[model samples]
Target: MAGFHLPLYRTNLIRSSSSPAPSAYTKPTVVTQNLSYWNSIYSDIESHLKKVIPIRDPVSIFEPMHHLTFAPPRTTAPALCVAACEAVGGNREDAIVAASAIHLMHATIYTHDHLLLTDRVGREPESEIPHRFGTNIELLIADGIMPFGFELLAGSAGDNSEKILKVIVEITGAIGSQEMVAGEDGGVGRPAGLLHGCGAACGAIIGGGNVEEIDRLKRFGLYVGKIQGLLSEKSKNEGCEMELLETWRALALKELEYFDSRKVEQISSIVGV
Candidate 1:
């Protein structure tokens, strides 16, 4: 749901033959240095996810949660979160907890989206959204993951309580009051845009970004989110115009124009410029 992902895009952060592969937005490249950067973030998030959703007695329910959390295609969201933190001068530690929470939130959203996908074709040989889990089990997985995301946030609350509180509001607001629990919208609309923006904003908040800086990154993320939405539509053969994607990309980069390009060098590279 989050916008043009810096971690995801920047990790392409793997450059491209042209600007970048549209698929770049979906997942990171393996055969690449930033690959290590992204993997480190993934490893940290995975650890937090394990601690928060430890495999318990039934194993049935918990296993799927872990599977979904670590499953591919993986996410660009956590990397973007940490990048936003770094872009604002916060280290990875400052944002790891929130990154983990955001990771789980997206996992639930992804599961919910697959649930809503008709025929559940593509990406799976069996033509099932999730070949392993039943629809009923998926419902459980969808419902289970998001709260644990919040648990990561709430559990990490401390001296940063005020900042964490704002981050809470940002994330929940993006997920939508009902969408978080019901998975109603599937985050295919403006909520998706907000999710991307929320991700950057949360990182900025945790990283101690000033009001102006946070707003700048938030808008940058929103533009990226819009591009992400259109690209998803285009991939499904929905006929999205390429011009719009370029426009959003331009606007996102423009937001960083006045700032020290050095800070956002990786993020700016998202477009492969």
Candidate 2:
């Protein structure tokens, strides 16, 4: 496999007693490199997202969406989507669009979550206009952003209608009221697990994986998501959180046993195992 390497140039100066020293160039040094497939995919997805969601009119709503979507520097969702696709032997390009959609979906959900929190905690003293606008307007913006995510999926689908449709269904269900929103009501369930698992499974489908492979990857995603949720819960005891994270990480690794070691390592990197 190809690796990432950086070239270092060196210049040597030779002193002459009778005249000015002449400069001599030495051979460039090359360091052994290991390329990260996930990083490459992330760069592609970032570029694609920027093009897909450019700034538009009605700056009040779109600006907030853009800020929430890009400002934080998204890494997990898009990386997982692309990694899952590659893990299942699918081209990374096949899942880039879906990855972008996944990111937008998360942004929309986060916007809604922020609005809900702001409603209870009251807006910050120096909050943006969208935050000051309160829940109703934010809701409208969320609603508007949601459809654009689907539209991106539709546009990226090209002639592969069935695969894209499956991805859409999986993602929509994961982010719907039953899963992610369930946490809003103070539920104990790990909604992040469902969301990540669903995203991986959808990416697997997009990558043309067989049913068995997709199922395995979905389980892997579930465990990874569970870890994420546990880590995010500040109220949870640190000892218990570490225990659960280890358990889930083990389970996630088990699911990827059939894949190549390199691929497994890449997935492990994403899961932070």
Candidate 3:
């Protein structure tokens, strides 16, 4: 028998094959090096976005607005981002298109969130969430360089845009309902309950009802809510309310891993893997 090696990545990689007899590997043996691939991918896409959108102003909201559309650079190190890029294994340009769309869509929601917050609490016109969030949006949109996310999906996105648009519409509707709005509304201090509810809905969308995914995202949202609740205590020593936001990156990665694995497993099983 040949000696077996452990799976190098943190998640499990299962393979099933049928050939008169069956073959199974407890883990996969693969290694990768250098973050250059993902960096180039993101950079190339960024370049394209710049060409199309073109930056005009310095104190603009476009730049920060762009950040809202994709996973913040803060979530993953260059290396990890590169690894994810490698795993995607698709047309280089298409990757950028998808990623860019993701960023834009996310930013749109953030813009709305700020608007809601601004309206809820009569903060000085400048002290509103819209003002703060708008600043970032301007910076993102006014970039001299193209955003990478636009390139991720590119021309290949097909009907995905429609689906994404639908999701945004639904989320927006939910926010408009009285149920989703509460508290100061403008500042970071939303009613803890509303935040948690929104977070749970987000988890459902991102987690896709997978048990592990749901568990992780729920915990992520719950912890975030707990932290917010603690901070809002406003009396004694309040603790951190940023836990959910802090863990969101980790949860997102995990959710994607589980979602992909389940998909692969389903495919394998259908083929009698």
Candidate 4:
């Protein structure tokens, strides 16, 4: 199997299937190397995002789009995408578009969540949660990026054209499904679960996994996401017992047992992050 790697050169939103993307990889032999591996993935994602959501005309619109996408602490959705792909013995490039799309959409969802919070908070400052730009402008930026996600995702799939099409369907349905619509009313608890499940499934599919492999990884993501949800006070207030975090964590690791040691090791690290 190919070792985990990150593509070095910049790639456009769209790439021809005939041309293979270039990457460099080394065996994961030390903790520092592991950190470097993850760091490289984050850097590559940010670099691609710069190209994807560039500073363009209409600064009012593009500026916040850039801020929303790039400014805050990065989320794990994009990392999960790339990690899942590599865990399944696929190139990181196979998952870049879907990864970026997941991050953009998730960021917008956070924007929506923040807007709802501000409505109730009534101009008062909140302690946590990265809030920036005016609520109105944030909403407009969210709307602007919503459709851009589709454009960025559609037809931008690499060699995994058919698989990426399937990923698009998975993502589109996941984002609009009842869970997501209801998730809007609450915190990221439910929505993050959906994102994790969808992110893992899309990565596996694009990585050329078979039905069973994809299903295993999807289940893996769901359990990990539940752990994330349970970590938040909002989700705990919603009746998730803190004890269940261990249970979910155990269940998540159990799912990894279905795969070989290397895949399980890498995936477990991703979930840990």
In order of listing, the candidates' clash counts read 8, 0, 46, 0
Whole-model Cα lDDT of every candidate shown, in order: 0.69, 0.66, 0.35, 0.66
Q: Candidate 3: give its CA RMSD in angstroms.
A: 14.2
> Which candidate has the top score in TM-score?
1
lDDT string, candidate 1, 1-273, tens digits: 113333223341122222344553344322222444445666776776677777786899888887877653555566677778888998888898998888787778767666644554443443444447776887788697888888778888888889999989988887875543333644333255677788788888999999988999888877767766665556556464767767887899898885788898765554434
lDDT for each residue of candidate 2 in 1-273, tens digit (9 for 90 to 100) = 244342211101111112222323322234222235545766798798888667787777667666666643242665678888888778888888888888778767666656654335433433442454566776676677778889988887778999988998888788776563444655533256676787788888999988988889889888867766664442233333455656776788889987887765665555543
The parts of candidate 3 lying over 4 Å away from their true place are 1-42, 55-85, 115-118, 122-238, 241-273
Ranking by TM-score: 1, 4, 2, 3
Encode model 4's per-residue lDDT on 1-273: one tens digit a residue.
123322211111112212334323322112111434555677777788898888898887888999887654455556767878888888897688888888887777767666745345433354355566777888888887877887788768656568868887877766774654443445433355777778888888888888887888888877766666554433224443545755776787787787887775766764442
> Candidate 2: lDDT of 105?
80
Q: Scored by Cα lDDT, where does model 4 land?
A: 0.66
Q: Which pairs of residues clash in candidate 2, taking residues 3 or more apart in a chain or in different chains?
A: none
Question: What digit string (tens of lDDT, one per residue) describes model 3 on residues 127-165?
Answer: 433343544444444332233333433444465564334
Candidate 2 residues lying further than 4 Å off, grouped into runs, are 1-37, 58-61, 71-75, 116-134, 180-190, 234-240
Candidate that would win on lDDT: 1
Between which residue pairs do clashes occur in model 4? none
Q: Candidate 1 clash total?
A: 8
